[model samples]
Target: MVRGKIEIKKIENRTSRQITFSKRRNGLFKKAHELSVLCDAQVAAIVFSQSGRLYEFSSSEMEKTIERYVKFSPDYFVPGRPQVELYLLELKKEMDIMVKKIDLLEVHQRKLMGQGLGSCSLAQLQGLETQIEKSLRIIRSRKAELYADQLLKLKEKERELLDQRRRLREEEIRETLVRPMLPVTLHTGKDETGSACRMSKHSSEVETDLFIGFPATRL
Candidate 1:
């Protein structure tokens, strides 16, 4: 019968899968041997059963063939350590950090996304303006209080200085008032006693220029 195409995957039937594994493994080793003999070449083949049996054929020693496979296989083999795996790990780390940054940026963008600055109603804007004005007023009040306190201090200092100046002037006046008297000059005229009294007194004389009975030095 012309059978329909089968999907190229593992057969689920246990007996059929074992039969296929045996047939394919034998065919693969037979082809490897023929090619090695006919072309006068080195060849190696290794196969593993589903139950962990290792089958191998080689033109040279099996161990030597395995060593060559490990050194030359490009897909899964690496010498000592894998540089490609280390690079992939570093790339994964960078991608993880980039993902976290993108998440944070998304959250920030959501917070500010819909604030249409030009679409707010006039009353709402006015309220905001009023709030700002109140804040400014409070600040100005605090500044005025500081200015007033400074002015009060300056005025108190001014009053103190004025008081000190007044005290000094009073001291000067008192000292002047208690000073010794200076010599006097007089212009005499005719008195009520019908005499021209020229009043003068020497320091050694008696205090008797008896026109009005007041001493000339006292006058």
Candidate 2:
């Protein structure tokens, strides 16, 4: 009959448990040695019996393997100290300092904006006033620059508008020059007074100051 597989559980008998521990510890050491030799791998194993006896296996020196483990597996190498946790602790401390600095800066900004002045001392208030004066100077300087820029832009726009007007006037003059002029014929007749009178066919009924408002035309 074939032997059945053993169900793994804690051995209840003390003597049996001790025997099992001894056998398993030796077997584990043997397996570790075989794996190291077969795979050309660095291996280390440590065990402690219930009686507080140390058992260990290593492909090379135990200290050397441990050093390698610590080097590669820095996170779980030492029980008391974790390198990653130490770095994170330092980072957290730096973050806390930065947060405090930001908070102080925010309070300073609030004071500069004329808020939160109730908690300030006389000297603090004076310092804030100086800062406000400095800020005002800077603001005035920037404002002047902006005004200058706006004036320059306005001047540029004015020049552009003038150039456009000039171009339009030149175009109008060109069209006028190219136009064909109409010939005028004067017809003398006797009016109600029976005096010599002249009438123009092209003249409108409403009179205009032709010399002042219109170009001189050939009569």
The backbone clash count of each candidate, in order, is: 0, 0
Q: Over 4 Å off in model 1, which ranges?
A: 1-6, 73-219
lDDT of 1 by residue, 1-219 (tens): 999997899899999999999998999999999999999888988675775455778988865665566567776476688645565476467657666876766754443443443655778567656766897899999999999999999999999999999999999999999999998756365564424452433334655545866545653
Q: TM-scores, in order shown?
A: 0.31, 0.44
**RMSD per model, one decimal:** 31.9, 27.4
Whole-model lDDT for model 2 versus the true structure?
Answer: 0.80
Worst 10 residues of 1 by lDDT: 194-203
